[model samples]
Target: MSKLTKYLKITKGVRVLDLACGRGRHSIYLSTLGYKVTGADLSENSIAYAKKFENKNLTFMVHDMTQPTGKDFDTILNLFTSFGYFEKEEDNLNTLKSIKKDLKPGGRAVIDFMNVHFVSKGLVREEVKVVDKIEFHIKRWIKNGFLYKNIRFKIEDENYDFTETVKMITLEHFQKYATKSGLEIIDTFGNYNLDRFYEKCSERLIVIFK
Candidate 1:
């Protein structure tokens, strides 16, 4: 668990939009906290799963963040390093600009991303996990400004592999993009504890902007 949800407080009646809300983890939590929430992702499977738990205040949509959004939102969340999946830096910037345009007056955003400085400093090369009779090995690294990870899983006689890559957008890069997109950076949190960011101490970057 990333624990990023602990730092959020969505006030009542606010319309919150969560981009790339995989599995609806944060969406459900925000709905329970009084915000009218919408979980949008490109994955229809995720939307289908989200529909299973729908309430009057909660809705799910199939939205590709790389494209334009028609609905305005009071608060938008791009959590868990979800911003950098775009293949290019400008593409990522465009997404932020779109978010700015879709947000209502005084609306805010919670952009949660990996701490690039820390990831660059302590690159994890290998990791292993066991899940429900499955054993998985993950190889991760930073190559050419992109974070790459390969997951190999074997459960009984079944085997699966997945490769994912993300462009590394640093704190400075995000601040510049936000400014360029007309969003003001209000505060930055280092972790779930809401501590002030330290150059080498923070594990993640959580920015609140409007």
Candidate 2:
């Protein structure tokens, strides 16, 4: 949060929209810093959980990020690699357009995504985790320009399985998206500390734009 404040030059009372805010952690923190924040996500359960922390300065709602949530936000944040969920590139581009549409004039936005190069080079193949007496078997791999994670677990005689996929978006791809969305790329950082981004060495692809 300190690094984010520094990067955005955020001040008290600024209006912020936490887009795709899974559980409103950032929105709650920003509200505590005196910012008026609204957090929106697609998950009803996540929004319900997030609403437990709401106050006059903070709120949460269910929203689709590919569409405009609201207007005139001083800053919008899409953190924790919250993007790249859509299978279609056009939908991903539309998400960027939605962010551009929701911002106030001269408003800034941040997109924190995984460094594709770094993740591809260090992909973990498989693992098993036991939590609260449930054993989760996980497998990960990259295929057809996307990263995939498969998870299987059993609890109380029931079997659960899920697969997560995220497009391997690079800085160049984001630059193109920014141009198409009428947003200007102001800065790019490697990590939370704001180091210069190195495609292969960086752990994150953090883009600050307006």
Candidate 3:
């Protein structure tokens, strides 16, 4: 888990709701810190994998965050650039509204998103990595506020390739939508450590709201 997430979980008796929690990484960390955590994602496969780490304070469920939810929570987390995965802008805004509805009064939220401007300015057209005997290569860039990332994995016997594109909106866009959803932006961090925004620098925009 990221240190920023650990900082957020320091509140006492917090009930944390993690949206689109693939594999329950942050949820598990929050749970270990004594915060009640519920992780929701659409992938049953990911949920099944996360179940391997089940504990008394942590739970996982299948949920499409673009829709409505009934559970009330004290703090909601949308981490790791998961907010822009939905193609429809209205769906994303409505999801924020739904999150506000599910939050307890005086509750807060943490939304971590990619810094689109920085990425667009300093886009990495190609990158590569190696894991064990497998070589993983990626080609990523931004065009018209949409981020395109293509991956090619080469193993000893086989190769696999896939591409994922997300609408890369800026931090101002989220502030607008979150304000319409009744959540006020309390603070913005350039990355996990809370720095100022700059062109061609920083990868994440961490927004705290209430």
Candidate 4:
């Protein structure tokens, strides 16, 4: 929140859109700070959960991130690596275009993504974790310009498997998307603390643009 206050330069009553907000954590926080915030997500369950915290200044809705949520928001936030789930590159680019369309003329946006180079260099191969009495076997790998994670877990007599995939998008790739979407890259940080971004060492690719 401190990083947002600094980078976005937002003030009280500023309109904010939390795009792809899973459960409205950020929206709730910003609303408490006096911002008018709307948290939108694709999942109905997530929206329902988030709605429990809604007040006059905060709300949640089910909306697709690849489409325009609303018009003329002062700030738009796409955090926690939520921008790269689409399978096609065009879909990913469209998401940026949607954000550009929804923002006010001078509106700002923050995209919190993973640093591709850092993740590739320090990729974890395999690991096992036990959570709530369930053992999860996890494996990670990079292939064909995408990062992949396979998770397998069991509960009692049932088996479950899931795969998470994200495109290995670098700063250069995002620059192209921003240009095409009529947005400019203004600043970038390595992590939540707003440290200067180092391509090879940074853990996050947090871009601030307008």
Scored by CA lDDT, what does every candidate get? 0.84, 0.93, 0.82, 0.91
Task: Mark the regions of model 3 whose C-alpha exceeds 4 Å error after superposition.
Answer: 1-10, 155-157, 198-200
Best by lDDT: 2
Number of clashes recorded per candidate: 0, 0, 0, 0
Error of 2 at 10 (Å): 0.7
The TM-score that candidate 4 achieves is 0.98
Native-structure RMSD, model 1: 2.4
Give candidate 3's error at residue 14 in angstroms.
2.2
In the range 68-112, model 4's lDDT, one tens digit per residue, is: 875679999999999887978898889999999999999999899
> Which structure is stronger by TM-score: 2 or 3?
2
Tens-place lDDT digits, model 1, residues 1-210: 234444445567879898899989989988887779999998999899998988988999999886758888988898888878876778888888888888998888888888888888898799998888577899998889899999999766888899999988778888898889999898898877778876676998888888
Poorest lDDT segment (10 consecutive residues) of candidate 2: 1-10
- Position 148, candidate 1: lDDT: 93
Name the 10 consecutive residues with the lowest summed lDDT in model 3. 1-10
By TM-score, who's the top model here? 4
Candidates, ranked, TM-score: 4, 2, 1, 3
Of 2 and 3, the candidate ranking higher by lDDT: 2
Clashes of 4: 0
